[model samples]
Structure formats: structure tokens, C-alpha cells
Target: MKAIIAGTTMPVLELTLDAGERIIAEGGDVSWLTPGFDIQTSTAFGSGGRGGFMSGLKRMVGGGQLFLTQYTAQAPGSFVAFAAQLPGTIRELAIDPQDQFMVQSGAYMASTPDVEVSVGLQKKLGAGIFGGAGVVFQKLAGNGTAWVQLAGEIVEYDLQAGQSLLIHPGHLALYRAEMPLEFASIKGIKNKFFGDSLFLAQLHGPGHVWLQSMTPAKLAAAIEPYLPEKSSSDNN
Candidate 1:
């Protein structure tokens, strides 16, 4: 299968498959497709082996589908496309046996059949429980290419050994497995105004990190005021 990411600012992943090739993606991400393709939903696993019911539940909490959708091409010249939810960029990463990436929860889009998507957990309780950032994430592993979407614009930084960067939790998009990540407390009165010790993601890296200009949480907050307010009568 040959894949190309077309467009910027709301990019879409277009895949052209040869006979018998397949691709898997998250549920609700499908935009369009061509003939000679079969879409199947499986709760076990997307790549190979078995991920039982319990595993599927865990994956759902990690921000993926309980059942994944697979598109298999029955003949050559078949095609499929998946679109990102937000106005941002779609990125492709090649995964080798020695490489694994920690994707922001809900950021994964699609992947070649050889890739496996699973959960990644943050060991730190500060970010996991106290902070609003997610503790579970979609872990992309195996030897294949995986696609992910970042909200709004994307920024990348390569940090040398012992180098660190502090970022708001909502802005983190993706980071390499080797990078050190933890939550740090914001000192002083700003925490009181915000309702808690405003936490930041402290990334100490000898690897790469990606940040997004817009996050779902931030976007919702921005537009919350314009949304219809709940009325007392509606509670009935």
C-alpha cells in the first residue's frame, strides 16, 4: 500500500492499496473510500495476536476504539481516506522493531497492518491523577508506519541529554519513548487563581517532542461561553 498525506490545515491521509493490502484506523475517522475494499470491525486486535475484551476496555480508556476498523483491498487500485477531527496536520512515522512512540491520547489516526496500537501509562501520579493531562495514551509499536494528528499548528523540538522543557499539559502532542516526562507544580499565587497547583509537563529529553498550538480542552474552554447554557427546566 502507498500512502500520502495531502493538504495542510486539516490534512487527510490517502492510501492506495495493491491487491490484498490492508490498513487500520480509529473508529469515526473514515471520510471516503473506493471499490475493492472491505471494512471489518474487530475487538481482538488490529495487527496480530489477541487483545481480549479486557484489553479492549483498557484501550478504550486510553482513547481508542473498543473495536477497530480495518480496510482490506481485494484488488489493485483500491483506496481509502481518513480525516483528522481538528484543523491541524497529519504526521506519519515509520516504526521499527526497536522504535516505539507514545501518542497523545486520541491523537492516533491510522496505521499499516503491521503496526500495533496499545496503551502507555504515565508512572507519575502528579500528571496522572492531580493534573488534567491523561495518564493513559495510545502506544504505537511494531514495524510499520503509523499516522497521528496534532491540533492546530505543530512544533517540534529536539532536546539533548539533560535538557528539559516545561509545557502546559494540553499542548503536548507526541514524544519519543526515551524522553523523560513528569509533572511539576507551578509555584506562587497563580495556582490559587486557577483552583489548583497549575501543573506543567516537565520533559527532560535526549529525544524529540511535539507540541500543538490548539488542544481540545483549550478549544472547548474558548467557546464554552457561546454554547447554550443549561436551563433549570432542562434538568427535569
Candidate 2:
């Protein structure tokens, strides 16, 4: 199977499959498909293994869909495409040595059959205290290529061991398997109230991280003022 990533700013992923080649993707993410490809919906499975119903439930716990769509080519030269639901870019990553990466929920698009997607690590409840929203990232592992979609304008960082980066919870998109993801409170009582953010995420990496310039929450906040307001006139 061959995959082509097309366009910029709002990219699309197109896969050309040989007969019998199969791919698994996030449910509801498919934009189009060529003839001879058979589509099936199930929990995400890989050349590595197929997960059970309980696994599907677990996937949902981490903000992933309970069902995944599998597309297989019945004949030669079949094609399938996935378009991002947000205005952003699609990333093609290689997962070797069973590389495990944590990605934001809904960032997964599609992957070669040898790859697998599962629920990410759960955080402690105290982590979310004081309005600090802890994150649950989707764990992508196994040996293969995985495609992920990140929100507007990607910024990359490579940190040395013991070095850390403070981030807003919403801006985090993806990080390497070995990176440490932790939660921290805003320092200082005055800054807590007057600072730009009340809570922050700390990424301590001996690996790579990807952050988005526009998270959904940030985007909504930016446009909230322009949204139509309700008034007595609405009752008329």
C-alpha cells in the first residue's frame, strides 16, 4: 500500500492499495474511496493483533471512537482518502521499534495494518484540581506508519533530558512515546488570577513534541464575541 498526503494548510491523505492490502482508520474520517475497496467497521486491528469489544470500550474512555473503519482493496489499484475535520495539517509518522506516541484525542486519521491505536495513560484526579484539565492522549504503538491530524499551525520542539516546556492544556497535539507529560499549577497567587492561563501542562522530554497554535477551545474563545447573542428580540 502507498499513501499520498496532498494539499497544504488543509491537507488530505490518499492511499493507493494493492489487492488485499488493508488499512484501518478513525470512524467517520473517510472522505472518499475508489471502487474495489471493501469497508468494514470494527475495533482497530492490526497485522499485530485484533482487539475485542472490551478494548473498544477502553478506547472510548480515552476519547477515541468505539468503532474504527477498515478499508481493504478487493482488486488492484484501489484508493481511499481522509480529510481533516479541522483546518490544519496531516502528519505521516513512522512508528518503529514499537514506538509509542501519545496524541490528542481525535488526532488519529489512518494507519497501515501493522499499526495499533489504544487508550493513553490515565492521569490522577488531583491533576485536574484547581481548573487544571488533565489530558488523555491516544497511545499509538506497534510497527508501522500512522497518520495524525493536528490543529492550526504546528510548532515543533526537541528537548534534552530533564529540560521542560510549559504549555496550555489545549495547545498540546502530539509527543514522542518516551516524553513525560505532567500537569502543573500557575505559579503565584496574583499571577494565578491575572495570568493568561490558570493552569498549564509541562512536557519534559528527551524526545519530540508537537503543539498546535489553535486548539478547538482557543478557536471558540476567539470567535465567541462574533457569535449571535440571544435577547428579548429573539422571543418576538
Candidate 3:
């Protein structure tokens, strides 16, 4: 199979498959496909063929679909495409037993059949206690290629052993699964007095980390004040 990533700011992933080649993605993520392609939707496979129903359930809990869609090429030169939902970049990760990734929920797009998407983290201590929000991350493991969509500009950092970075929870996009991740409250009395963010994500690594500059929540908050307000007559 050959893959091509097209466009900028809102990229699309196009895969050209040889006869008998198969790819898997979450249900409804396909943008388009060629004719004569065999499509199968099931709960028992895709995402690495792990535990069937239980695997599907875990994916759903991590903000993914319970059903997975597999596209097979019946003839030569068949193709399928997946488009990014937001104005950002689509990145491809090499998944294997040694190299795996933990991606924020809703980041997964598609992957080879051997890749597995499972729940990584359901909640963080600081986020659960201070923020009242449960954060979810999806683990991409197994041996294959996987695609993830990140919002806005992406920055990559390679951390040596014992190196750490503090990140806002929303900006945390994808990182090596081996990296240690946790949430911690921000220090300094000035920040507390000024009502700054209470908690930040701490990631320690001997691996790479990817951070996105924009998130859906930040975008919504930015434009919310400009939106027209509702009136009493509108309510009626």
C-alpha cells in the first residue's frame, strides 16, 4: 500500500491499496472510497483484533466508535481517503511492540489492521479533583502504521531521560506511550491570585512528545463573546 498526505492547514490522507490490501478506521471516518472496494463494519476486529466486545467498549469510552470499518481492495489501484475535521495537521505514526503512542481522545483517524486503539488514561488526579473533568487518552499499540489528527500548529519535543515539560491539558496531543504523564497544580501565589490555570500536565520522557497550539475548547472560548446574545423574544 502507498499513502499520500495532501493539502496544508487541513490535510487529507489518501491511501492507494493493492489488491487484497486492507485498512481499518473508526466507523464514519472515511471521506471517500473507490468503487469495488469491500467494506466491512464489525465489533470483533479492527483496532488490533483484541477482545472483541470489550475492546470495542473501551474504544467507545475513550471517545471512539464502538464499531470499526475495514476497507479492502478487491482490485488493483483501489483507494480510500480520510479528511481532517479541524484546521490542523494529520500525522502518521509508526506503531510496533517497541514504539507506541498515547493520543488524546478524538485524535485517531485510521490505521493498518495491526494497530490497536485502546483506552490509555481515563482520568488524572488533579483534573479529577480540581477541574472536575475526566480526561481520556487512547493508546495506539501493535505493529503497523496509524494516523492521528492534531488541532492547529504542532510542535515536537524530544526529551532525554528525566527531562520534563509542563503543558496545559488541552494542548497535549500525542506522546510516546512510555513517557510518564500526570497532572499537577501550578505553583506560585501570583498565579493563584491572578486566577490562572490551576493545573498543568507534567510529562517526563526519554521519548518524543507532540503538542498542538490550538484546541476546540480554546477556539470556542475565543469566539464565544462575539456571538450574538439571545433575547426574550427569541426565547419565545
TM-score of each: 0.87, 0.86, 0.89
- lDDT for position 82 in model 2: 93
- Deviation in angstroms for 17 in model 2? 0.7
lDDT of all the models against the reference? 0.79, 0.80, 0.86
Clashing pairs in 2: none
Quote the positional error of residue 109 for candidate 3 in Å. Answer: 0.4
167-191, model 2: which lDDT tens digit per residue? Answer: 8767889999788777776765344
User: Candidate 2, 45: how far from true, in Å?
Assistant: 2.8
Q: Which residue pairs in candidate 1 collide?
A: none
lDDT of 2: 0.80
Error of 1 at 101 (Å): 0.6
Residue clash pairs of candidate 3: none
Candidate 3 has an lDDT of 0.86
